[model samples]
Target: MLLKKNEIVEIEITGMTAEGSGVGRVEGIAVFVPGAAAGDRLKVRILKTAKTYAFGKIEEILEPSPERIESDCPCSEQCGGCAFRHITYAEELRAKENRVRDAIERIGGLQNPDIHPIVGAEHADGYRNKAQIPIGQDKQGNLIAGFYANHSHRIVQCDCCALQPKPFEQALDAFLEWARKSGESAYDETTHKGKLRHLYLRMAEGTGEVMVCMVVNGNGLKGEDSLAALLRERVDGLKSVLINSNREDTNVVLGRRFRTVWGQDFLTDRMCGLQFRISPLSFYQVNHAQAQRLYALAGEYAGLTGKETVLDLYCGTGTIGLSMAGRAGRVIGVEAVAQAVENARENAALNNIENAEFLCMDAAEAAQLLVQRGEHPDVVVLDPPRKGCAPELIRTVADMAPSRIVYVSCDPATLARDLKLFRELGYAAGLITPVDLFPRTKHVETVVCLSRKNPDDRIEIDLDLDELDITSAESKATYEEIKDYILKNYNLKVSSLYISQVKRKLGLEVGTNYNLPKSENTQVPQCPPEKETAITEALKHFSMVPFK
Candidate 1:
């Protein structure tokens, strides 16, 4: 019973996938239908089919799910944003929590994990402090500004979006009206000849100060003053108007060059009782109110007692670290982006946070550098990108021996992968809380607390030298010996877990089972080839294995 493209089939949606698509089955093969929800009965047309799964489009909803609701925004169906807008907020929260739990248990190989309920947003709509709408022309050659349609670059002409505040809509409308009058054409990705590319807007949630930035293909826009005046008159709380020149033929929205046209080049936003200067390139969270909640949860997980030295990895603009600076003895923030580090340092100074310091380096390299300097943190906070922490970074953090590691992640699958690595390195995953930062969207923010397992509690085996066969020290390398060999020969400081993983892959029994119990243990991935070579070389140098 293989499904064919354009084949209409009846399905009873049973659940939801991580991508916010509804799960249904036809003859035991899973079919994912977008715009569908759990508990819905639908007639779907198979768009694509694979050996094990299929993708479909909802043709008709024979029976709607109880959690399903009518979306208020007309563009929600066409726009790529807000995948879960058709479902109730309660259902969204439940789905997010379940997603986190499933990732931890099913993917991370944790049993009965302590996963808390999702913290729902206070206001689902109008919570976003930033909006970047693409400007283009409709089929009639009329100026338009809106979001891209789902999986396509085609602009869905929208004057407003439900996720953004009303002021953004007004600002967008003003820009559209002005562009139409000025006869400026939208930038085409194919031709790359138009002037206007995008309208980037940011609003200070607390102060109601708005910053409008027009991303143009050139240095300046024609009649910029008139456009600024129209925005100031039409949009309340308008504070700054600027232009970002992105001359390069790329898909990136903001360029490196910026010129203020009307007001300041940056706007100030207050968060966690501290004021922050936000430029167009700053990585501030879109949902400010929910960010406060997320940071508060991270702080709570940090459990600062005014005497702990906290290391904030991936500390964007020093927000998370500065949020806890008042209570921490010292806060060291590390970020890879140079501009973000500059902003973080300035933010620390702006907040008068003398106890906090910012450093520009990759998270793993910074942690290793700190360790080299004999600097140990009581708490290490990780807010890595969506790909999650690198295994080497996780190993470094574990080697730093922080009492607690607070992981803030945007992607559950990656978080689960990192958590598994942490567990292998003697960290026990603890309370994990999911927060609905981006409402009406499939994305969810999660904070996980990992505490180092007590070394004394680990099972230790005593061996008698007389009962064992006589062997030289090089016959079987100790973990330290293997590590030293790798570092000395290859200049690669490999983790003991990596060596153990290589050993297991070579059909060698590990000395001790640091992994989960056999029943709970899933197949952990082997060390990457580069590191595996180092591990194999170490094993050979220690005479643990004969030459291949």
Candidate 2:
């Protein structure tokens, strides 16, 4: 039967996409409906239809799914952030676990994968550590700062969101009232004319330290100083107030240049007793409470001993490395971002940790060099970006043959791909744990433990607690000793030039087509002379020689 726009059709959703869209077969053809989840048999109105599939919206839910529940936030349906808000927490976990399992089996081509129960958060709601609200004016010209609407750049004035802590919501409300009185025009993406572009607020949930950055479209921040001063007085936890001017239309980044007007440039957050200082640009996990659970699982997967040397690749701000520092002999982390490396170093110092050290370098290059130097880590913990481990990095790691490997990933397809590479390198999968850090979203974080195969060793773990001594500090000491031994044998400090060279040769290139800076068409270069030089200097670590 042909479906018409806004015509309610009851269909059973069979599958779900990574973007949280539901899939249903309509006359042997697939139809996609947003705000729908698997196990949902509902009446959805067809919004638009293509030759292959149809787009829809839920007009009336004739029969609610067993997993379905009322969304906590009023704006949950409209906002793009939370996708699984309507589902119960238990069901959400199951869905996330299934997603991971499916990705491994279907995308990774693994048979009967051993996926463990998902690690859950202590608190399901109000666990967010960071929130970025785009500043824009309402229909009545009232200044507002909130998230964009679903599938649109238009700002949605969300005064109440369940994910953000009470302090964050209060601060935003205060800003909204102040901005309305102050007559600051919200940045209009459509017109490219407005004073305020984004209000970036990040809080260290454990410490109650808050960092706020007001992203504007222009260089000069007129009437921002007074606001900053007021914020310092009103906001108890306000540590940093910055202005980031991003004039570009594209949403690649907020801005590069930042001026700190109040307090410090960054804020500190603690996870598993490890302190991590985060800046405006630094990427940290959003859910603080849930992230702790995820990291704990990763540490368990690593099976760290005090005598073991551990290598943490793609160690953003060294959260995992620093957290596991006490349990390991030495924790050496490699990150591509220099700023993140600096932050990681600062975090280590702040925590008074001497055993952990971080370096700014490409993972592939560092691995190859470590292998060449005959100083390989006993255990390797990798938490890579959504892209997962590069093939070169995988090959290098395989050759090194770490005794134990803990792989944490946000994208399952990539995880499976990398797992396949590891399996080929004579590693056997030990355990796979999926953690739902981001609820109401299709995304899931998974930690997989893989050990170098020993033909004679098939040791069985005793599940009984009384059999093992949990009170003893022997495990911690053993992990630390191994780490120290590895670091002493292998020099940690190496030049970034090699890593930079390899990345530039193989990694994807960004240009004008991707809304990047184009200089040839202009009289002067697109970037300011000083800024260009600094960027060039930074890229040197990645082997990207600056364009002369």
Candidate 3:
């Protein structure tokens, strides 16, 4: 074996992974070392090893990269909350830009894609407007409150985090004091017992309004009034204090039941020159300033001309749609969460935005409804969850025939996959801009713009069939034969709809009557790599170009 557990070795960090780990190679084997940056020489201790790669931790730094810097937080390494704390902000932005570019070229199969430089955060520290901290007890049976240590559930005691505002520290101190004085035990995940579960704090960056919420095992707490009074007195700009009851034994933090102990149950914040009511259960970006930048970039990609209609899918609380409402003739926002839809309507009314409307439905269902109503939008914006958009939904959006698609994604791999599908649907991927919303972490947000490909851009080929060596029977492959080959070789069943789509993209002539009727419903599964390759070969066998 080349390596063993607890083995120490010296390696030079050459690159970084998408998960913010420094990568080094020994005998062509990759070693991932956390808390290490590129261009750094360090002594590392191997913790685990596999056939092709190994995992290790930095033991000592013999030399540091020029991008490396001294972290201000003492618990940064132990807390695992911030991955780029030891590196400069410039390096973080560059790494994020490279990550986005690599995903598009390597995963999406795009060659030399146009990826702009990353938009760096104006303030790297104290930029987070929301904080969810776990409450636990130390080995001495004393109360401790902080974030989890790395991947483990052990809480690393922290009085303050650099990512949160100054008011959060004061609120933490008050909560800790109140919990200890009231003799409330912190919830233990292993035994599934105790009262206090977590402390959730949110701040409105533009308005400076603060909200304090407590997650507990029960509905109410003893001395709740005193705790509220203490927080209001200690934390400035306090607007709301609420309690969330999570009686279940699951890892999920917030429960459905919420009780207002003091003030209102929601907080209001302004984004993109509009006011939005934020509830505890509502989905909002943690970084307020960077979100503004992100929305502005989306608006630029939409290229609204004041006479065009825009459709936003998975529009959380209608932030992006509302931001572009002024420029577009009309904006329609669709969200699955009922409460979020209500909040979106309320926000529209609050801002007096007359051109925006929100509906409570899933993206696919809403797209189908719009198509049934014969509504066509000039631009479509998609902001989906980490799993990304479903292939069916992508097809539905393409059916809308929107001239432009602005996709806002948090996961790069999923974005690349979806972009590939969009490419096959006659859209040309352009200008992908990565935004550093979460500076110290591995997470990155990207805004990609895809324009409908012009008919003139299609490739034209002239060939002499008489000089071809292959026979007519060998050169022709039926669609059914192609499907069977894919299934037999890859063990993946593909839908006729998907095959038709691919054939159409490859410039193959599908008969006018080849499409299924509207009444025929079927499930089209995602195409895996092996299946995609087989399908491409089938297209090639029939003398068609599989890709541009």
Candidate 4:
């Protein structure tokens, strides 16, 4: 059946995507329904339809799933921040754990990946330590401030957000009050005019300190002292208030110049028993409690002794490295951002840590330079961004021949891709832990331990296939495994013939006289391009080798 716009149809939700959208099937076409729970029988009206899939809006919940919950946020429907607000917390954890597992097995090509249980947050609500609320104006030209709608710049007026602390609410209210009183013009993204663009807020969970930075179009805001007083009155433990001028016509939030109008330029915060001075450019973990949990797990995986040197890559403000300084003999941190490197050094000095050092350099370049300097680190820790570590960086780290590698990643897909590279470089990732640092959101943090495989761990074997009378190329993965991989990942079913054909095309020895048509006029359905690509990727994932 062809799905049309405004067509009402009943569909049963079978699964969910990583973006927190429930996936259902109508006449075999997958329909993505937002605000839907897994196992829901929903009456959905098709909003838009594509060739293979369609987007639908829930007309009515005919049957709710066990994972479904009553959303407490009034703006949950518009603001896509709290992705899993409609689902139970337990279910959300389940989905995240499954997501990591799927990434490792399907994407990382690791069979039977040892993934531990997700570390759930104790307080799901009010967990965000950082908030960037966009400032806007209503259609009537009234001052409005809130989060943007899903995939849109339209500000949805929200009095409060469940993900932010109560203090953030007070600070936002105070800012709005000041904005109205000062007649501050809300910035327009389309026009790129007006003064106030955004209200950036940060908190120190350990020290109970807060920093409020107003992102504006110009260098200054009118009546800065008055705005600071208003925020300080409502927000408890207010430490700093500053203005960040972002005059460019880009969607990027922060600008090039930052000037302190009131208070200190940076805010001091404590994490893992170490104090850190957080500037506007410093890359600090937004989720404070869950971040501690993640760092602890990464430290455990590092398995550092008191006498071994540890290298922390992408060391933002030296949080992880400083936390492990007391355990290791010496901690060396490397970061590309200059300001973050300065913060890292400051954090080390603030904690009276004399054995740790921070270097400002790219992760790949730093590893190469350290090799040239004849410095060997016992353990290497990586906490790369969403794009993950560079391939050359992984190779350089492997060249250093560290005993262990602890990797912390925000994107599972990239992490898995890098893990595959590590396997090729003689390093093997063992147990992986996925932590729900961003609860009620689709994003999850993962930490994996990759150890240098010892010679004793491998059993040397030389096989003579001719002696066994087998005249076929041996594949690392079986046909059934490849078929299952394609089915689960792309939701497409493939036959053994297609897999063999793809392997043969790649110069792999498929076997003598295998998958050959008996007659010249035999009608064999060729594998489509999509299925062939999937099969080829599956072959690569399984470590299949081509005939030399």
- Per-residue lDDT of 1-548 in model 2, one digit per residue for the tens? 56667767779998777777778977766778887767888888888977777888877776777777877787777777887787778877776788889888887777998888988766777877788887777788777666788888787778877888877776777677667777667777678787777777889887899887878788856667777877777776888888787888878547778888878898887778777889777768888878888888888887877878899999888888888888899999998888889998998999999998787888888887666565568889989899999988887786565788999899988998888878776677779998878766667899999997654332211122222332232222222333243345433322222222222343423221222223323211122233233333434433334344
The 0-to-1 C-alpha lDDT of every candidate, in the order given, reads 0.85, 0.74, 0.85, 0.86
Candidate 2 local distance difference test against the native: 0.74
Candidate 1 to truth, TM? 0.83
161-251: candidate 4 lDDT, tens digit per residue: 9999888898999999999989779888888889999999998888888889999999898899898888878899888888999999988
TM-score of 2: 0.79
Per-model tally of clashing residue pairs: 0, 25, 0, 0
lDDT of 3 by residue, 419-446 (tens): 9998887678998999999989889999
Candidate 3 global lDDT: 0.85
Which 10 consecutive residues of model 2 have the lowest summed lDDT?
A: 458-467
**TM-score, structure 4 vs. true:** 0.82
TM-score of each: 0.83, 0.79, 0.83, 0.82
Q: Give a tens-digit lDDT track for model 1, residues 377-451.
A: 999999999999999999989866778999999999999999998988878888899988899988999999999
lDDT of residue 111 for candidate 2: 91
